[model samples]
Target chain A: MNKREELLTEKQIRRRTFIAFTFLFLFLGSAILGWQWLHRQPTDHGAIQPLRKVLDANEFIFSSLFSKKHFAKTYSKDLPLPHPRVNGKIGLNSAFDTATWKLHLVKAPGDTLLIGIDEIKALPKTEIIFDFKCIEGWSQVTHWGGVRFSDFVKKYGLDEQSKMMFAGLSTPDDEYYVGIDTKSMMHPQTILCYEMNGKPLPLNQGYPLRLIIPVKYGIKHLKRIGTISFSNYRPPDYWYERGYDYYSGL
Target chain B: MKKVIHKHPLAIRWLHWLNFPILTIMIWSGLLIYWANDVYRLGWGDRTVLKFFPGSFNKALNIPFRLAEGMSIHFVFMWLFAINGVIYFLYLVFSGEWKFIAPNRNSLKESWLVILHDLRIKRGLPPQKKYNAAQRIAYTAVIIMGLGMLLTGLAIYKPVQLNWLCAMFGGYEWARAEHFTITILLVLFFLIHIIQVIFAGWNNFRAMVTGFETENIDAKTETAMPTEPINTKSETDEQA
Candidate 1:
């Protein structure tokens, strides 16, 4: 208890009550109006424009502070998921043509490199066992084996293209696509995955090739990559257009 | 006859009231985020008594499939919540108001007595100050809970950038669980707090809103009650 209790007159108490409620209403009123205005704004992709704008700002701050020195923690390969769950099938068309599959690499539109699974396997292989996080809040400690995306970029002589603001990947049918920061793509753990649990990827798990990026949510791990392209501007993404953050960094 | 006494400072009242709505919105938005992975339940090994929520409950609240909106509101309002909490903490310390809010060693010894009084098993409450022993402990615990929420929120939000912090909270998944648990505890605290305020009656509630309480002339002896018990504790651990 406070030793100095300021005894007040009834008149003083009434005046304080008036001031208090007046301020309280004003504060609460503004909060309500602010939320209403936020929701009423036009949509940017799936989110309202204002919310998207902040997300953009948040991305800028997060990306600036993101460091390559800090790697995502790895677990023992023995502890990896025996059967990883598959999520999101927007671009995964149930169609024909695993035989004709060639990874189309586009550097500034005209410079194209057609790569086969053999070419990726020729390069050094990297395996990572990390908690593969999904934006939906579930995660799995799964093992992945692949050629590093950075190695693929280096081997293809796309050093200049790799330095661009973003890298966009799309499925063969081109229905589902993802745009990612070139910085994240350059992380040592970002891989052009061809193997999962020490075997060739299953058909449903992006069979021929997929992206295994440990630093981001699973949504950025575009599957069955038909084409890889570099961009100075943000590329179209499946989830970004459906109310997810364009960056979606972990 | 009734005499009025200043029970709360103007700054304290504003901070407390602001917290109610801000926190309510935070919890609401949090529910939307947790709806995606609501795995927690009050049960063990197939036995179950309660679920965080059922499908019907979520459907009624319109709380399902609003992850984007929930995330947007949560990220935006987190700054407000943190700022309000920090300001409240600083004011409590600098204004010497913590003396009334923070618990002493005696609080632990006396809190059970206050509880018995609350259950109406005891005939009378233990002599106390601006806050009873139970109140002092609860208020202090809540402030600590607020801090836990902020730290846990940061750990999960930027698990990559703040890898050290994420590890401190026992990695990302554990941090998420901690954040969710703290929210549940805060909601429980809110339920009890509201019920107690109702039990305390309008005269006591007005003290929060108006910063003044009108005391019955017959209870003037309480003027002495606030000092004697607390002065003894001051010599022990009141301010320690």
Candidate 2:
């Protein structure tokens, strides 16, 4: 071997080390900047709102690009019982009169309809047994029986004139609220649920009504729906405000 | 005579270093998400051998009530992670670096020998090229695990839309479990990789960063004695 091939020249080593360090410093600098960008509180959601916006944008793109007709996996009716766990109790904390409580809905500006439980039951009942996924990483195959939200919307002539972008639901005390995309709201599996496991909903299970959305995490399945409103803009969501995704889709 | 030989290419070095932080963040954020439902255990039924994590482990790490933040970070960084991985894989293919990375026909047998050598049960390591048999197998397996994580992640992320994928993995819950298991496996691979790098010494570690290593010219010429450590002096004694 030639003597020249025996070693890296002093200058060559220096140059390489300098170049490597430069790259390292550049990477570190970019990473710090990227971290700052991700943690920047651009919105009121939290310190990570900028990152949250990216996630929301992902949800938006997925929702817009994909057809909502895709059905969640449904199990055979003969399958074993599903024990639905009570995940959240934010809206269900308050005491309310079940008899006087009606589903207050806003079809359009200044157009309102107060739907009683009997009216909700009058719509064609849909019973689906599907996996109910929670954001917490657990899932249950729960059987839900109720009128499809789309059917109810159609029968009431809601969204007939103007297709709203979102469906907003709130608790009676308005402590908790969720805004769902109209497409997901009108999905065939989405229902204004009144029964669970072949029986009327227990008080803890949202009693009169709750939203049974198979295509969404349990968080979006707003319980004890007090008010239903259609909106062009995305309504404030309890969890979204608390730093969860606005879509909360499956 | 000493020779400064190219070890890792510039692109490979960059990708490797970039993946360090990216995978670290992925694992950290993944841990935050997993804390929500840390239900995995080592035993069947009620006879618990060990849990995925103890409550104290979570408390020590402050891994609580961060699901929303974790999900946001995960979804945002996942794009970067996937993109970097894709670019790295393409670079490996186009640059023909896969020759060093992909496990070949002799890898299984050689990997066992390498393992025995590592465990001090065998006298010496198997002869190697750019990467040893064990490294080739591990690196390839980690890449496959990355792909598995991506697929399983998508299945669980969009179970309804990606119903076929969910079904392929047995179900949505199974997909989540698979994803978590892969994450844990990647973590284990990372620990072992770091340990091996440390054991391999500075010349090997620096090659991953600076893309070159000083080796004895005689060592390069002698294919018969592959495992012999090159004794070569360089101008940069710090790297020696």
Candidate 3:
């Protein structure tokens, strides 16, 4: 057989190279544009806001599509631990007057109810042994006993207000706060946890009361709940301001 | 006589190169997320053999306190990764390029010979085709691994909404482990792939980039290979 001809002539090779490079340039240009667009999104304390939007969208979809009745897996018993690890120290740094600290319940702007731990304890108590997952990726199987938030909402007639889309919780000093969807807040396992491992919660673990939300990461389980507010719009979250997801659900 | 053979189709080359950077970014951002957890290890009960990463390693790499940034980048880039993979797979199916990469019945046995040849334990390679048997297996396995990453990633990302998927992989923590394990495997595959590309020389690498390769026409006939190139002119001409 005669010598085979070249698959691509010089002109063709140059043309192919030009096309390849052109496509590559186009791809790079689009990537840069995407990066700029992401950075330009509305930010919270310098954290990219588009990410927050993405998390909210994810939460909305999950809430609408999935059943709220689906509970987190309950362990037969709590894991043996001297104490759970302290993952964050943002709100725990101050010395607060525990005796005078009242749980401020906000219905709307300027409409508030100041209630004590006794008022919360007056409701029926529920106990659960469930895995507590943290955004930091560690998990602890811990026992908690408290009044379910749903029950508390019903008893206080907060459930009557149907426009409430989110529940905001804050520490006494308001140094740290979290925003939670009302649906997650009303989950069967969500509680105003005051007792842990069959005893009153230690000061390090949010002494009088903390939010125990099984459906969410530990970040949403706001400790030392000092203020509770119902809002139609999403409340500003500490972590969300710091670039973490607001939903932060499992 | 020496001749040029149309090797990788233009679309295939584009997809392959595009995946390289997209996957690199995915793995890099994944590492950033994994740094927050960094819990995997290889050992028995507490007698540690190798931690996924030691504290010193993390410090050296500055891997801590970046979870927020890592997560944001990961969530954003994931769309690109998934879309690219889906497009690539569709192209493979539609263009009939799957035949070159997908493993066949004889691939396992032939892959053994290919491996032996690679290791220099055997004298010569098995008969060369568009892709050798080992290449077919490795390429196919990588695609499957990509799918695994996507599934496991979704399972963990929305565990409650996709609880069934999470449960299918033995729950949330297990799904996370599966995702990380597959990532490590893909990284391993990437390393081996690079080494093979270097060993295979410039012509092979050029084919992936330029869509053509120089071949000895006499050798092609001696091997009794089909006259048509792996990527026929008809397929590439339209793109050209």
Candidate 4:
């Protein structure tokens, strides 16, 4: 006695159900095929081209909406890492001379500028405590003393070159590298870190100078500065070449 | 006399079916991502009853060293999951099908009886129009959980960019915990749903796919319906 009931025959129900199930199988079959196809595509810089496209699109959206006002929340200095953890030793493994370590800046294809740790420290020192998040799914509260990258750009008179699409950095041995977009580079929280806790950076934790962009995962916080360069296009990144998102924003 | 009833609309059936695979992929890929920080466990503080996942489980599932692959899949397939969910919600609202899906005041009370009946502690089912009370509650709860998954996923995904949203969910770590917990709940829901469907018998299950359910009328009832039209929807669809 239900409203909208109909007196269809058994054959009609059977026919309809058969058709419905056929369509269901077709959809599922196609879904499986699509998945296989996506994976089978040739890898483009360690990721499938389509997947990389999506990651790039994600970068576009996040960077487009990026604001300098938003800062990674600073925590109390008391909660700093008692036992610092380093996930990788790519660039830090090589023997290096801290005394001769001058940050090489390639302003253009030809123009190069050299800066020392004291020059970086001379601009202004800012102390910040924040959670340093790792892409491998762990986070620790850390205290870093550094010069705000914004001030460094201003002091070095690179205000014009700072607008480039990306700022690429490499370790002294050219092992670990990262390509950070200009917008994130100019964030108020972005700093060229020199001190960890209350003392000079430990040898393992990029002593002397390192990039500390809190707006990104720990991977983007390249340790042991060696060279810096800007380009209109995105520069090479170690993690990005291994299928990680280029933006890697927080 | 045998008769057929229009239980589900074509649109509802299509959307419902789409959700099955979409949700499966979302959960499977989510498991891949959560494997990185699989810290949740049953017992707390020193003594442990059950770990969320043992190393053996991870090995069996091939979940190790796949963070990059897991992330790429999760990020890419998220669009399909979100779009399907949004369309399903809109369709339910616009078609007035939500009436059958939404829980009523007596749902909690009746769902308990439904559970008892299924357990053989009771006899007759609560009078069901479209969905049983247990089904109403379970279905509604799942939709709410799906929405929770979306919001929590976004919060952890862009904590700095969407700081306000992340703060609303009690910050990064808490939001991740919430997201993982809801996933476990969804898995539970999926298991129970599959068991119920199989136990309900083939006739009832077929209705979902074909949009029609078969009903039987006794000879006396059939004979008494002489003055009425054979078709029910002919009048109901056009209104009284």
TM-score of each: 0.91, 0.91, 0.87, 0.94
Q: Candidates ranked by DockQ, best first?
A: 4, 2, 3, 1
**Model 2's CAPRI class?**
acceptable
Q: Poorest 10 consecutive residues of model 3 chain A by lDDT?
A: A1-10
- Indicate the worst ten consecutive residues by lDDT in candidate 4 chain A: A1-10
Question: What is the TM-score of model 4 when looking only at chain B?
Answer: 0.91
Q: Is the docking of candidate 1 incorrect, acceptable, medium or high quality?
A: acceptable
Compare candidates 1 and 4 on lDDT and give the better one: 1
Top TM-score: which candidate number?
4
Error of 1 at A198 (Å): 0.3
Which parts of model 4 are misplaced by more than 4 Å?
A1-3, A78-82, B224-240
For candidate 3, what is the total of clashing residue pairs? Answer: 0
Where does model 3 exceed 4 Å of error?
Answer: A1-6, A14-43, A49-63, A78-82, B45-47, B218-240
Task: Write the candidate numbers in order of decreasing lDDT.
Answer: 1, 4, 2, 3
Note the residue pairs that clash in candidate 3.
Answer: none
Model 3 CAPRI quality:
acceptable
lDDT per residue for candidate 4 within B181-210, as digits (tens), equals 998999999899889999998887888887
Pairs clashing in candidate 2? A6-B2
Per-residue lDDT of model 1, residues B1-240, tens digit only: 235667888899889988988899999999998998888788889987788788888999999999877887787678789999999999999999999889998999899999998998987877888999999999999999999999999888878778899999999899999999999999999999999999999888888887777765556564655554433443345237
Clashing pairs in 1: none
Residue A107 miss distance in model 2 (angstroms): 1.2
Sort the candidates on TM-score, descending order.
4, 1, 2, 3
